[model samples]
Every structure is written in C-alpha cells, then in structure tokens.
Target: MLPPPLNHTSSILVIGAGTWGCSTALHLARRGYKNVTVLDPYGVPSPIAAGNDVNKIMEHKELRDSNPDARSIAFATCTRAALNGWKNDPVFMPFFHETGVIVSGSTPDLIRHIEKDEIDSSKGDFITLKTAQDFRNTMPPGVLTGDFPGWKGWFSKEGAGWIHAQKAMLSAHREAKRLGVKFVVDDPTGNVVGLIYQNGDVTGAKTADGTVHRADQVILAAGAGSDRLLDFKKQLRPTAWTLSHIRMTPEEAKRYRDLPVLFNIAKGFFMEPDEDNHELKICDEHPGYCNFIPDPNHPGEKRSLPFAKHQIPLEAEARARDFLRDTMPHLADRPFSFARICWDADTPDRAFLIDRHPEHPSLLIAVGGSGNGAMQMPTIGGFISDALEGKLQKELKYVVRWRPETAVDRDWHSTQNRFGGPDKVMDFQDVKENEWTRINETEKSKKSI
Candidate 1:
C-alpha cells in the first residue's frame, strides 16, 4: 500500500546524518516527501560504525536490570518488526545476517526472564544447547561456559541480526537522493522559522540561508545534538555513551571463531565474530562515564574523541582488554590489534523520548535512543512518519501525551531539573554546558545503588 500523500508541501530538515537521522530521512523520502533536507556536520560514511549483531538474546539481563522503561520494550517490538521488513526486502537481503544469537547468564531469574519474554528458545529451525558441555561440543573447543549459572540457550534461525550501519546509511542516502531529497552540510546558526500556519498551526521550518523550506510538520532526528534544536531541554537529556571495539588477533579469533554471537551475562559483556573484518567485536554493559557537551549556538569543530574526561584513552583500552581476559579465558594473553570508540545519545529514562515536544507541538524530538537507536531505527522512522501523517495515532498516542515530569514513574532515575518547565521557552543559553562533568563526579562518589 502506498503511504498517504503529505498533507502539504513540507520541507523537513534532519539535523544529523547518524543512523537515526539517516533512517528518519529515508522514511520521509519513502513516504513521498520531496523537500526533505538532511543536515550533518560530517559527510557520508559517518565516523560512527554500525553493529548488526543482535545481542538481545544475551543482553536481556542488562536491559531488565539497568533499563526499566516501558519505552525500551516498545522500541524492541518495533525493532523486531523492522528487522522482519528488512529480512523480507530483496535490496536489504545482502546487508543482514541471520546467524541467530545465544545468551548465557549466571542468574536463573535472567533465564526465566528470557523464557517469559519468549526470547529464550528459538522458534526457528536451529539446534538448542541444553548444557555448557553441549555448547562447547557444538562449536569451538576453547569457548568459555563456566561463568554462566545455568544452561539455558535459545537459537533462532529466523531471529534478526545486526546490519552494517555505514552500508545501510549509504543505501538510505542513495535512495533519498533518488527521491529528490536536498542535502545540507551546514549547521543551523539561529532559530529556525517559517512554518505554513493554516488556521494557526506550524507547517515547516525555514533555514537561515533564506530558503523558504515549507512542510506540514517537522521531525527532529538529530542525535546528541538534538537538545540544541528545540525548546525541550528539560524534557530530553542526551547523555554520551561510548563503545570500544577491541580487535582480537588471529590466534584469539581461532579460539572463538565458531562462537555464536555470545552474551556473557555474568560479566555484562558481549562478543560477536566479525567475519568480514576477521576480528572479534566486544562491548560491555557498563555505561561509559561521559556526557555530551555540544554548543548549538557556536558549535565547535568536531573532535575525534567526543567523550568527556572520564573516558581517558589509555584507561578505556586497558578496561576493554581486562574485560576480555576475565570473560573469555581462552584469549587472555592474545595481543590486541586496535580499538575504536563511538558515542551514543541516551535519555534520562534510558528509554527513547520518541514523542512530540509538549509545548512545541509541531516539532517532534527523536533524540535519546540511549543505546538502542540503531536496532529500532526503521520502526522509529515508520512510527514518526505515521504519527506525522495521522495514520497511526493510537500507535503514537502515548508519545504526544507523555510528559518528562513523571520520568521516575516511567522507570527513569530522578535527577535535577534540567529543562526549566513545560511552558518555559528554551534558548541557547539555557543549556547545561558543564552538566557532563557534574554527572560524572556524582557517579564516582556513589556506589552502584
């Protein structure tokens, strides 16, 4: 079925070209929006790398423990749907891998959670491992299984996998270009104005370059830089999360060559084999000690290390190596090749703020994916498009009505009031510039409570 026609001639401006921005822009293009403009400080092949490894099978413990937001569940549902769409699409076939994912945790509660969620056992045609010995015998010899408390495994031959993020972004951009979506590489300096108000309502944004870009509505898919574009500072918090990919040597690869995307719940670390790059990609559940601090008014030059002081280069690398040694004893002494770090924007609730601004009803804020943005991109895009076009109001009904004040009730950790209030107008000066350092300091002093 064809997407509904855009109610008006809308020129949507996407602020960032990261996965979220690119995905949202592509969704708009797919919906037949012609005057869409995606603006990113960086050009194609964004510095951020994409991981298609589905660690949901393994990371269930972390999500339940650390993330209690219902939005995460909603995001997961959408992500699963998006994966299904990609798996069925001929063009996206080559980009997705269906290796299936495996989870091994030390807690029975974790196992029960997985089973209860119906994600524990694979519904697909794949062998299930009932014991540690069975898993070791089924795959490589040296793989570690002692850390897991019980032997519960799930293998879905049809479960969704990760995508090559850069490739997918490129594909979406290419398609957007074909659909006549304009590209802007510059950052917005002043407040964006110019919306076609029919009977007192905003229609779109007009760029500083005097471009009268009109639209029936606007969607904000800006990543970490989202707080700068709209007046919802208090409602949306963009925390910086860092992930380091520790490259394993050939000898280390030999030890875990056949290991399925393994989730080590005991240590809060996950590993996946990168067949194309011939390296084992590892990431931990430990949240990085950094916060995003970008100035929208006078945005500075981009930095290779966008993280805060807590994320020291040497210290982070050492942590990654130590984590690998502890989790996978087979590769303890192997020499690490290299490591790359990237930032993820998180919200206060740890769930995505995927709704419209309370006051600025015309503006939709798509920031704060926490770390699940890439996984849920396509669904998010579809939902945003549907919300704007008014086709799926019940689906996005919570988005418009939800408020940031009841964040803790929504499973978010309560903190100081950042955004002034619902009715307060947010400007460039109102942003908490040094908020990251303060948050880091606070975390260091407190125990893991």
Candidate 2:
C-alpha cells in the first residue's frame, strides 16, 4: 500500500511553464502534492529565440570539454532520474532517441574525458577517439574520408541522447495537465504579495482577473522572466544563445542521415541529425554576439539577445560547412534551409541557482539553468522536490554545494590563504551576514539532519 498523501492546505505555485517549470510542477505532483499551480506571462513554453539555440550548442561544447571536476553530481543525478522517468513514461519515449552521441576535439585529454569508462552510461553511450580516422569511422557513408586532423570522441551505445525540445515541452505540459496542475497566464504587474503569498508563505497565485487561489508553496521556475516575479532587478541576467537548423539537400541527407550528434572541438561547431525532418541542426559553441535591450517594466532593466544585430558570421558558417564536409563529405555543397534562436539565463559561473529564497523561505527559485536545463530537466525537478521535502539525496547535496557563490568563496579563501593575507580569514559572524554562506549552512544542516 502507498503512503497517504500529505494532507495539507499548502498549495505550490510554480512560475513559468517552460521545461524546467513544467517539469518541477510534474515532479511535485508525482510526489503527492496535489495543489500545484504553474504561471507564465507568455503562456506555456515561450517561443524559442536565437540565444537559446546557441546556448544549446554551447552545452554540447561543455560536454565535449568534459571537465569532470566541473561536473555537477546534482545535475547528473537529476539527469539520471529524468532519463528513468522518460524511460518509464510511454509519452516521453518517442521523443527520445537512443542513437547515442559522439564528441571530437583536438585535445587528447578532452577525448579521454569524453570517452571515460567510469562515466555513467545509464543515460546513453560514450566513446573516445584517439585519432581523426577513428572519428571518421563512426559516421555513415559519405560522412568522412580525408585525413581530418583532430582528436576523436565517441558515445557509448548506452550514452545519453537528444530530445526534440518543443515536443518534450509539450509532452510535459500535457502530463502536468493530466496530473491536475493548473496553469495561469497573466501579467501580475509585479504584485506578488497577495497573488502568491499568504501570511508570508506560498498559497496560490492570483490571476490578472483578480481571482485569488491558495497553495502550500510557490516555486519560481520562470527562466529568464524569473527576475520579474521575484523583483530580482539586479540579481538576474538574461543571456542569449543561438541554434540553426540547416536542411541538407537529398544527397547530403542521404550521406549523413545516420550520424549521431557530432561535436567538432577544433572548429567549435556541433551538428545533430534531425532524422524525421532531414535537417542538420548546427550551431557554434562561442558566446556569439549579444545586445542588451530595455525591459518594458523597469527603465534601466535590459535583456540580452544573441542576434540583436541579425547577422551570422561568415567565418562561423564556413567553419560549420567545413566540419560537415570533412566529417561527412557527401553534403559539401548542400545549402541550409532554415534556422532559429533561443535564450537562456546565465549566472557568472554558469551554474544554476536552485534553492529556497533567503528572505522568502516558502518561495523556491529554480532558474538560471544556463543551457543544460533542458537536458537535465527531469533530474532537476526531482532534486527540487527532494530539497523542498527536506529529504535531499546525496547527489542533490553535491549540486547544492556547487552553487556559484560557494565555489567563489572557496576559491577566494584559497587564494587569500595562498597569499598569506591575515585579514582574509572569515568568521561565523562574517558568514552569517553573507546570503550565500547562509544558504550553504542551511544545506549543510539539512544534510546533517
């Protein structure tokens, strides 16, 4: 027999209906929290922007770089959980491809890391290549032939793969609805007090039409728009990333159709096969060009866009074309058909911020996933659920500690000690005044208990 649901009036309000927000809502619901609500001013899964596309490419770049030291065990744990969820859920299965992933770079160390055997293969396959020829061999016919000079990386047969982002989001939304989570589309005008808060705790969000609802807790997974909900005017920064769907001609598609996701480390270009559509989704890992535009609500508030200039660098396109030609020689002259962009919220250290608010303990903030949010959505939501319930797993504990602030403090103290600075020593009093330090301590206490 299953445990009885927690009989409480504490409803949970989740802001943003995108992948992260929706996923969080779904996870909470699965955990027996019935009164969960999701809010997004723009409605479910906001339109994909150029910035979002580029950030996706950069995420693959990070995987290729494979800084094991930088790996967030929390993220990995969540990714595993999400993968398991998809594997068990019939609705999400079709959207996921088990074709596996391949990574190629110039550095042997990078290749070794990419192909590391000890890495978790439960999500998918992983392989590393010692030579360019080894990398060439993995591709289907017309993929590679010439002596491409680069280190090679390959995915294991059981390695992680990609999902159609829009499709996955839609499925999650459908699932959330099926599980009885309510979605409210509204512009709250920044009046979060009566709408989402009741007696200093999350009740339920009020719609713009003035209908008041109550909930047990409120979760902030609003992505870039999180700042608006939390009044984090200066704390959050919205960044843009780009992605391009280049349709290869029949001949090109025929030659490279079977290629798994490919990351060319030397040129910083990555390509994935959109099998059903016969398009080669390509993008670069570089930050690309960005511009800051004003936010309508705040006078000085600005959001960044990857294609504010609306220009694609010729050099970047050439590099992508060259990679395709060298890696899969069949589509050398194939013209690209279409492309799109998206955005992501990035912290200074590029780590996600997933913890309860310092002042607003009832409000959980789950944004700033940077680019890896989509890939790690399932696991992230599960961990959030764990944290909220005060039952954080060991893996989640690792991620909580890896927050940018904690990492920065650790580095700062190490540097201070290295320099023999007497004044650099920190005390509990100093730590108590620091918000991040307090968060870390809270996490520590939670783990201890």
Candidate 3:
C-alpha cells in the first residue's frame, strides 16, 4: 500500500546533509514544503560528502553511457537541465568554468561513444582531435606542455568545464537555509545512529546522543554511510577513489588556468587550479577501493564501509605520479600537498537508488552516486522530490526503483565500464606499512579509524 501523500506541513527529515540531501532540501523548500529538517555530522560541504572538493568536472558529452538505457537517457535529460542551470542559474553560475573539455586515451568502447556523439549531437561544437597537438590547439599557447603521446579523442566547447565544488555546495546550503530549511549539525543530534520504527514502519531517526527525531517521513541520502544504518540487502557497496593535489605558484596557476579539463580513462584527469589556493587537483581513474568492516546493522555479516582518512594508498600516489609525468611532466616530481580517498555508494549497474523502501512505507532511499552524482547535482533533487510525490516519470522510476534482486554477494567487484585501475578491488587494510603516502606526522601515526 502506498503511504499517505506528504503535505507542506508534514515533518520531513532528511538524513546526511551531503549533496543529495542538501539538494533535496533546497528543492523541497522551493516547492513550498515547510517543516523540512536536515541532519548531518557537519554543515554544508560536509567533509565526508564526495562533492565537497576543490573542483569537479562540469557536464560534458563524453561522459555519457555508451549503450544508453532508459535510466541513462533520463539522466542525460537531467544533465541538460543541469547544464542550463550551471550557465544561467544565479546560485551556480559564478562557480561554473566553461573552459570546454578534452577527453582522450579512453577505452575503445568509450571512444566509439564519443564518435557517435560527435555525429549525433555535435552540431559543430563536438569534433575529433586525433593528435597531441590537436588536443593542445584547443587551449591557449602556454598550457598543456606534456607529450600527449597516445592522447587522442573528442572535444566539446559548450556546456563543459569545472565548477568550484565546495563553493557550489555551500551556495546550495545557504539557499536552502534562506528558504527556511532547518539544519542540525551537532554530533549525537546530527549523527544518525539508526531509524526509529513503530509497527514495522519507519517513524523517525535515532541520533548518536539517544535522541529520536520523529518525523512523518524520513529520506536516507547518506551517500556511502547508508549501509551502517540499515541493510540494503547487498545492493549498495561503499567504494572509494583516490585524489591528490599539487600546489602551484600564482604564475603557474594563471598559465594553466585556461586549460580545458583534461581526461584520460586509462591514465587520469586534472583541471585548472583553484584561483585562490592554486592547488591543482588530479585524480587517478580506477575501478575504486573497498574496505570491509563489520556491518553495524547486521552483527555477523561483514560489508564494505568507508573509513575517513587523509592518507591514500602508495599505489594510488604512484598512479597519479605516472599520469602527471606523462601529461604534465614538470609537476611529476612535485610533492603532493595531500591526498584523500573519496567514498561513494556503488550500485551494480552504476544507476542511482531513489525509491521508497518496499517494506518501510515511511522511508525513502536516495543514493548510489557511482561517480556520476556530482554532475547531476542541479537537477537530481527534482527527481527525488517527484518520486516522493509519486510523480516521477515511468522510465526513470524503474531505473532508480528499489530492487534487491540485483544485489551481488560480498565477493562482487565492479567491472561495469571501468577501464583503468586493477581488476580486483583493493582492500583498505591490505596495504603494508610503507605502502601509503603518509604526508605528515599525523597521517603517519593514524593507522585506521
């Protein structure tokens, strides 16, 4: 049976003040949903949220799924809306840098997808660049001095670049607050421990401090930490990817500032440096990592969990160095400012999980970022709110619907469209003593959380 429809005065509690949570609150408020409360361990731009970063790639045509499904097509539509918002929305425009994007060295399948997109939707904006010089010609004269070698792919001049991620998230949080969305950021009260149930229906959430924040509806948007609170029946696996930053001088930042976002599926990708901090961020493209810890909800079962740490694996650092040496050799040997392993919940098909719980009528789940969540930020909430209102389009509803049947066992490793990284998922604790990029004294002493 369907739960009662939510009204504006209904008490709506959103857990995890991360990207999806904040976006949902903002959209809900904009839609006149009053009495909405958001709970999190921190305020806007939570340290744990994957979107909380120096910058992230803006929307681009090359990142679309090769064999598009109904869900992929729906997300593509969302990407169109997101591009419009990034270009015109006052809240997000200032942070979007439309420097265009050059995708190179991708797998054969992705290359085919690029070729197809060029023919189907380029409209003269998306075209092929077959050589390293071809890639460099797109940027100003002084940027991208690397030996492009095997780098050859497509480029699109419209609706692509990087966005100041942290600032964008903060902007959303502020707007949501201005719309009268209440936020709780204190520990115990903000730290959600579990859900409160009444007669088999979720009635509220219990925080770490023994307080139960009752609500008429509860939405779980806790990116990777969802498994710790409730069992998703092996549908969601917490996985992580590593990213590092290179500190650059003011002049260097300026020289490289106009470079289009450089991406290589097999090697890695990097974007312009932070204008103020001048920290050039680079991420190693990989299948992602898994850290198996005891599942809190299921006492005897062990599931992959995310461990918040600043140190990254030594192999990850090596990969980053290799990418830099090949692309921007000047900064290849530069010591990293720091590194982090960002975590996200992985669904088997890389599609999002956004549907009401089959058994718990009062609960809704909105997660499974699968590394594509950041680009959909501007419009993802609309889908969630529509789903909550029982008005989501039929095509998308099935894509994000709750389906435990797709759940794989603990031995499952993601092989879907992943090109780089090792075939097997690396266990967090499997790294030996010296196999970590321990940058500082604090990082060296911190073994595990």
Q: For residues 119-238, write the lDDT of model 1, one tens digit per residue.
A: 533334446667766555545655663433355666544554445455556676676677777766534422243333344444455556655555545666656555555544345544
Report how far off residue 227 is in candidate 2 (Å). Answer: 3.5
Candidate 2 per-residue lDDT, tens place, 146-168, comes to: 45565455555443556666566
**Lowest summed lDDT window (length 10), candidate 3:** 440-449
Count of clashing residue pairs in every prediction? 9, 36, 0
Off by over 4 Å in 3: 60-68, 106-124, 294-301, 408-411, 441-449
Pairs that collide in candidate 3 are none
Q: How does each model score on TM-score? A: 0.68, 0.69, 0.92
Over 4 Å off in model 2, which ranges? 1-9, 49-71, 107-132, 145-147, 185-216, 231-237, 249-258, 266-272, 288-319, 329-333, 401-449
Local distance difference test values of all predictions, in order: 0.50, 0.53, 0.80
